[model samples]
Target chain A: MSTGYHVAVVGATGAVGTKMIEMLERTTLPISKMTLLASKRSAGKTLVFNNQSIVIEELTADSFEGVDIALFSAGGGISKVYAPEAVKRGAVVIDNTSHFRMDPEVPLVVPEVNAHALAQHKGIIANPNCSTIQMMVALEPIRQKVGLKRLIVSTYQAVSGAGAKALAELAQESADLLAGKQPEELSPAILPAGSDKKHYPIAFNALPQIDVFAEDDYTYEEWKMINETKKIMEDDTIQVAATCVRIPVFSGHSESVYIETAEHADVAAVKQWINDAPGAVLEDDPSQQIYPQALNSVGKTETFVGRIRKDLDVANGLHLWVVSDNLLKGAAWNSVQIAEALHQQGLVHV
Target chain B: MSTGYHVAVVGATGAVGTKMIEMLERTTLPISKMTLLASKRSAGKTLVFNNQSIVIEELTADSFEGVDIALFSAGGGISKVYAPEAVKRGAVVIDNTSHFRMDPEVPLVVPEVNAHALAQHKGIIANPNCSTIQMMVALEPIRQKVGLKRLIVSTYQAVSGAGAKALAELAQESADLLAGKQPEELSPAILPAGSDKKHYPIAFNALPQIDVFAEDDYTYEEWKMINETKKIMEDDTIQVAATCVRIPVFSGHSESVYIETAEHADVAAVKQWINDAPGAVLEDDPSQQIYPQALNSVGKTETFVGRIRKDLDVANGLHLWVVSDNLLKGAAWNSVQIAEALHQQGLVHV
Candidate 1:
């Protein structure tokens, strides 16, 4: 009677919950029942998945009893308390966190840019922001073929997107600054963030803070890349701006965006609409010294644009260099590509 | 009897010619006779400076006889073959080499944004790109308290701006990827652009190619930060755009930038015009996470500026981070502050 569906993940020993259990074991999610949950200090920890190891259990509020599809990457205070107790146990949740991403009834999805707002999910959705879901999958095929109207990113982030103790404090402050120590003699406590109260030395360094000083002084990871890029490009009058930082990368996430195209968009039709969009790749070719690279986009779930060009003075300006994989397409392969777009839109029922 | 101006340096043991012999031994000029030069395999090496050692020698065509100011950081093919043989033997060169920075009779200079374009020098002046001399000393005090319009930068450069063997190949490919080795079993060669024919691994990576694929596909360090910020702010209609990446920092460079003022410039008067500008340095205080980082602007020669804000949507936009020390204010303390502003504007003659 194992006819798939009944899945869950909720921070199963994180770093984007072990890449959402290795993207639900190579997705096409049929799952039948996995459950892993966490905290209570990663409960009896086990975690394998497909070949089944599982264990981890401790999350409460009845840990989504008969879950149909959960996910939630465990922090936005455990998805603002168990993502409504895994949507009051009917499950659907998705949520990677930035607390229900600008919650207008949540739905900040990015299944390659708004998977039809996941059927207007009332059981929560939100996952944008691993630098705004790789700049909305490298700018939703140039905002659906030239009409973006303004943007300006700058990231280059990575230190495993600030998790797993910021990748063990960037490998113990890069082996204590290559063994000669002194970044004020080591002991960093974790990233330009880990509850930001001042903790620097992102080994070899460059941390124009990532997520603390909000409002006018940006960085709540630059207002979640300027408000989850206007709610996943649903267009809040299209203008945006960001500046993230946090270098000494350990797992891809390189931006440097910059857009603005209400019309006239050429660089070969925006590199043939980012090589015909959908999860973007087009690692452009500046004559063979190809482009897009942050340790070659880590475990890549694709979003690797390249130094596209145009913009010598804003005639519909441009310029890219995207890159991806900050814990798989910036957080558990975009929450298992939004649970494979809600099990291919039947919106999962279990 | 030695009275004060003979100087020289040329490529005196590289890395911005040993920081222009440690900025001609703590600058207030008055050198009298130093010399050095290099390349004939670092001609008999030696170095030291004030505590006296010297030696170097070889760069011939008669090494500038009565040298008066010289400087020139080796390579732009040894400053197009010995900077006009040290400017026809009388020597006033300066050069740092982007091969006579846009030579419409070369002026370029950035002594805190055009030390009066060094009284229009003909005897070779030019220094500018070390990421465009710390972004023309952090945007020439907000382009003179707000009258500039449109600009966009990105850079985060450093791998010792591809020198000192790209900082010993990013400290031997970051101790060969922390001793496990794999960026394709490492052997990077140089960097994103060490004469660009492919050489990656900027350790722990991020290399949106700098310096080598000019025009349309950008990168010649993004058209030297878009044509040396329009020739050191002698404004060619002030609209620019750049990207230039290369990370794994070994010496500061950072940038981010983005500007657009011709008026309404707030953010505490752009942090009090970059804290009353003259070589810039305001390290913004987003509630004391104090911005401008890049290993705290290594060996700082000013140009710090912090994350001044605004532009949540244009209204004369703004946003800066800028940092410096791309070998001291981007290349031997801006070529020893343009030979201390050509020895305080008397345009240095011997």
Candidate 2:
């Protein structure tokens, strides 16, 4: 290879992995070599990058040979199996699964909030959960300006976060529903949680559960938000609570976020902090009927925040509406951002 | 009139008004005569009540001459103009519009929570806003069991709350979107808030604004939740904050509700309280993947409560998912229930 580093994208055919390729194409990171990897099912499939056709290679123990970086998004099982293998082959793995996120040695990083944590990476850097990633980008400004005391968020998540299959399911189910098919008559093979035994129709409906139940009856998605926020912000003292709900939207995730800051900041100052923050766009003029909307946030890389107001009762409490494209900023763009950060910090070379 | 009340339903052709007619048909209150009233534009229409086709009459100041109970739901403007006229014409008004909900003279009643307030109504008993009514039914039991200190709720409201025309707008916009039309290409006349200057599509997306902005940058819908909760519970000391959102759901309104109780209560006690509460159904079974889903709650009169869990940090903090049919329990049924309470309390006479 030339002076640039080699990069491999596992799960190259999946939803987020597809966007990861697009992000890689647009990213300024120098790449003399690119490797597209996936499971055996997608091994022979070809995807385009830089106007060149690239054949997908099956991920294996030796697939990371000479690779400077490997971005993994296949699933937790695949990540648990192949991530360490990739790392052993001298590739820094940026894992996009829940498998290694909570590992004490694994640095869960959102470059906007915790890029410095990349220095502590021991070959594996866990990308924070999609919901947590966007939230970190939106709230890090507030956390930096005024110490965050507590956070309570209710998410209006889209089906894309579940994967490409969930997106197809939403499309098919919605088509079936609009054709006058009874909801009970339609079969939903995947939704809410694919690993879970049950499936529900997500077209024109809201599922209060995202992933399987974890400790204290919270879903793994909720726990991911709660724990990942702490890990990313690097402050376990900030109490976080989350209710993750899957709405019918296909791409963007919207959140109704409530926060209690350690210090009092007026709405104007808070807006200014968000306006000044990178990767965050303020869309909050109520007089002009301007606010962050799910449809408007689609295809956008920035986190859109609006409806910022102080709590009528609590002096330090505030509320905001946050929206972002789950596939872009929440998953693919974030992983690529980490890779860019790794490159900028000279941590990409193994 | 034959030992029964003569009931008049204003806005008889509306989504809630149609449900009100259905509710009256099933109500325990004896209605000897039913008068259907609407605007002059809908005056020539006919609606069936109790298997009888009733001719719709244009609502005027003289429409409630002999009516003992007048249910006003056309709009806030109409209610402001006609509710007092109905009451002056010897009728007890149960207004479903927000025109008089916060009036000190008009008692805001969610019958299950504050039916006793009906006895003090000065010829006008106000039904709380659609979003507020369901929340009251779910939380009143908890408030009674362990005093509520503070509540923060984020609502996933339905399109029908905007009325019949908004429902039509959603259907058309959804069909156009499904046919591969761009979001901007579709003409959306009503949504988010019709009276507001701008409109947004509600098909497969979420809008953070539910109504016009009010004081402190809160939407009028959010303020309705905050102010009406205290009014209906008759506890001005209970601190409430709300973020109201309009989602793609057709009927049911779902909320992510978090509350801090005055005293400690475990999950089991909270579940038991919800299970025992009138008009509240407990659907929370985490292992079974059961929660209050919007689609499943459609057309249901009772508010479904689920996803009940304690906060990981705060001892007294609790969270719940509450869903209800916005047209039924949230509007018509709640108003009819209030009428029943007034009848049972011997307060229906002029």
Candidate 3:
């Protein structure tokens, strides 16, 4: 029998944090103790799990005293401050922030793609960006079969990736739009880029910018896809470019990924490889009009891939559509999966 | 003094045909007489153009006998049968169908990109695909400056391009969804491909397949973008690829275009080209958080360009976001532009 261990849930009141609790309930890892941690503002809130009410405690450096593992998802700053403290207190940290993803010591883990990287983790395992995690699950199988040379991805991301308030913003904005309110006067508080001074409505339109713009005019979200893919795959030679856009949907994230394989690839073989790959479900059937769609993918842990096609001009080029529930496979469940992998592989001890 | 041309509008009752009438009212084309023609089923339908209700007459071979210019937005079958008859009767046919776009005898024109090609037209001028027209308006200036070598475009197209009923379907489906209905149960009668057996919902979703799958899994809409870009730009050497997707918006179409310039290109120079180019507007301003948005382009006749950035990997590659009212610059205005061009060049006589 697997040993039951003490666990701490950081940022328990936020969006991904709540999902982390939901995922932890469904996880295979045996838990003897659960500590719900949040900012002081949400400290007194109670959340129910497994027919028990867990009163949230304000997160502090001392909160991880008896914790075996801690899941962090509040924000980068919270992770940067409390993650190491949780680690120094003898708990393994599975971070869902961009904080330590590129750090040499923290293994950026996607259980299906690079669970092996978990063995080298030094008390901290980093969960990648939501967009990167889904793409990794869909493409890692193909990358193993036919060596990858280049990747070009464009995303149709949902508003839920922004946060819970952003979700409320979209809901309110959409209701306003339906009730004859102008899109301009919708009073958007958080969208396109949350930290930026201005915000745009995500109702009935598309925003080509996501997160803040970074170097070379690429958004930080796009950069995360580029940088995290290289780090997680452990191959920096691969050419990756991305254009991430925000759409009006609430949950699932969809991607249009184009890749140039080193070897000449066949669609039939690619489809077979995807079907057999772990965490990937091939939903492509042009005749029956069966394909992966965003709304159809919500609430699922596995990534749904479809619309596979070969480029006419480029001999070895291939295109695929990928969709997944960003909150689950992209963030919370991914962090929980890493903790589970650490337990499954005997990489962590309470 | 400029002379007015006797103009004939085929498919007077369709979505694009109605827009053509509205555009003609605000057009520079010196139209002396207007004849509204449609399929027999719509013959008696009355449409108001220039504050006058003109009954749509049944389209026939003799409909264009006294016309100097015939703007055709009818299906390709009607254009194929009547366009030749219209041409033989001394009328220049500006077809918005794919029938004559690839013909060696026809000039596929996006006036801002290649008005000179009109001089060699054999009485037929094909208005390039809707998606292609907007991209051309955005990119032609950049192409002229640095010379384009490659293009990869992914579109977020509105439902209006599918037809009037498709627009109604979107509105109805969205209303149903807002009323807390299941998205899967929403009946979709027209989408991705109208003629194809299956239809999918466009309310709060994105359909990657547009215009049915063709050779190598590319949709015919995608092929239209690829082929029409080459034809209208008059450059077979430029490598182009596209993934055309249908979104929930009603009218404007947005594209995320990535291009590789032949020469080393600078972002400032590229912005200048787009600003100075006729029929194109630049909206890029990262500091001010400004960019071309799809909804903002509705009912506008000019293409909006923004979010331009040089590729991090390819030294000469750049990215752009192009948006336009697909009914305006993409079809109706482009057709009217051709008629105005012919009139200004003294090729048309009232």
Candidate 4:
């Protein structure tokens, strides 16, 4: 491993950004110095990392100067404008936004699924969406062994994916609800999608729409999962449908994924394959009441899979319950993992 | 319509039973006497209906002696034991339990989807599962126009489906979590599946398993949806898959349903048919950000349908968001609707 690499994290004050710092402290990357960068609003705020209080600097194009690796998580707009600048400054950008994920030159990667795709990136290695990342980690093993033909997934996503304010909204709404206030009275400021016209409370309910409705009536989040799965897996023949719903959970995202494999396999063999898969932990044991749950997956990096069931009617159909921390495996840890992969492959510097 | 006929409501104090009593008050069924029956523990307790306070009677085979219509919302075991007695006592029993749902002699009826099935009932009509009832109401109209070939559904079910005690647990757990207690410290008393060995808090989390695990790793709740949909539609060739999950919402059950039709149809045509369907209200308008929601579906009997989008890849595949009050359309209202259908068809006396 390379020693004394300077790392900068954009959007250091946000939910995923803070998690990025937390994950960085625990990461194996040999870092001599770490700089936190966020918007002008969060400048001068200090966050603790490795027991040292580091002051957050205002993010600008100049923030990438002397930085060996830059991890971006502010949002798509910030990444779209600053990612290329960071790359030009000789810092390999591991962007956590959707800005350049679909770019032909950029690699949208989940480290466990397509780390090899990292080799060809032009400085930017995009982290897949939080919901998509966990699913990719859980399903890629199956995809490699049996081949995937179709996917139907419904996500029970956390509000924290929207950022710190959305997490606050859930807490506020819960307090209001417990105080006997009407649900309609609790205005949701940042949920489902911040840009969407209508806001629905996520304290004790499920919002079916996530991100915004794109062309063909699917939300951008749903489309991201469908498109990113194919791009990361490098397969387009897989028919994918996703319902991205935001629930009241604070951190972890749980998905009920049903897949139809291209090749048929026995249930016992599939279970064995999952048990042996990397970065995937099988927690399914019906007799022992072991199953992957969002409450249990919080703050964990490994994708937890349980409730594996063979379909009753379809011969090749399989069901899996996958759960992971949206901030960890979904975004921050994934972004840092890409940086680790870059350093391991001797490709950190542009 | 029948006038001055005796009506018996079993399981009067239960969640669905409470809603059943509420629905009966607004129903068109003319009643001379209304008898409330529950366990012997709740006997002698008085409940008010039509401004008359009637004492609750213990459930017994003789309780249905002169009853013209009997509504049962107790567990399957109780229904299995007492529903037959009600039928033998000359009451047209509308069982809101799973005991008779698959019985060859019984007609599984969703009044909006298959009211005609009631014509051949052998003195007992079976109400479909709460999750199944809402989806059937939303999709049967489209199924009539363009036949359905396959279905994949993931349910965001409410805690009330587990009964009033489970609802209480959700509220209690939420309070504990917001008060800064640990998740594991907040002991889950009843949720996800009450009869299961372990319980998980549903306050800010989702449980993938609703009922106990059944054949092929599918929960009994999921299997009911698969089997009930086929039996209610009277088609054995259609393929169905279900993942029943319990969310924190108290009453409404929301479902993300993906369907493949036998014939290709335009989105506008499908929306038009849904607007015209009985017991199904179209609330879909992406432009105005209007869609069905669990919080908004409370106390509503009609299944709310929205987010109707045709698949971008498949020619005949369609996706829909279906929501309804599980206590209303799911249990009490469906049972009462079956009773109304029997009266309308002059079969109330069996």
Strongest candidate by lDDT: 2
Please say which candidate is ahead in TM-score: 2 or 3.
2
Of 1 and 3, the candidate ahead on lDDT is 3
**Positional deviation of A245 in candidate 4, in angstroms?**
0.8
| Candidate 3: clashing pairs of residues | none
What are the RMSDs of all candidates, in order? 19.0, 1.1, 2.0, 1.3
Q: Least accurate stretch of 10 residues (summed lDDT) in model 2 chain B?
A: B113-122
Clashing pairs in 4: none
Taking the tens digit of each residue's C-alpha lDDT, what string does model 4 give over B154-254? 89999899998998899999889989998989888677678888888888887888888877677899889999999999998889988888877887999
- Cα displacement (Å) at residue B88, model 3: 3.6
lDDT of 3 by residue, B150-209 (tens): 888889888888889988888788788877889877888887678999888887788888
Compose the digit string of candidate 4's lDDT tens values, residues A1-350.
24578999999988988999999998998998899999999999899989999999999999988898999999899999998899899889999989898998999988888889988988888888999999998888888888999998889998889989998999999989988999978988888789978788988888888898887777899999999989999998888888889888898899989899999967788788888987889998877668888888888999999889888778898888899999999999999898888888888865
Q: Which ten residues in a row have the lowest lDDT in candidate 3 chain B?
A: B341-350
Q: Per-residue CA lDDT of candidate 3, range A156-236, in tens?
A: 998889999988887787778777888778898899878998888888889988899878778899999999999989999
Listed in order, the DockQ scores are 0.34, 0.87, 0.64, 0.74
Query: Can you tell me which runs of candidate 2 are displaced by over 4 Å?
Result: none
Query: What lDDT score belongs to each candidate, Candidate 1 first?
Result: 0.82, 0.91, 0.88, 0.89
**DockQ (C-alpha) of model 2?**
0.87
- State what share of the real interface contacts each candidate retains: 0.86, 0.83, 0.53, 0.67
Query: Can you write out model 2's per-residue Cα lDDT over B1-350, one digit (the tens) per residue?
Result: 47789999999999999999999998999999999999899997899998899999999999999999999899989999999999899899999999998899989998888787887878998988988998988899999988999999999998999988888888788788888999999888788788889888899899988889988899899899998988888889999999999998788999999999999998999999999999999999999999988889887799999999999999899999999999999999999998999989989875
TM-score result, candidate 2: 0.99
Q: What is the TM-score of chain A alone in each candidate?
A: 0.37, 0.98, 0.98, 0.98
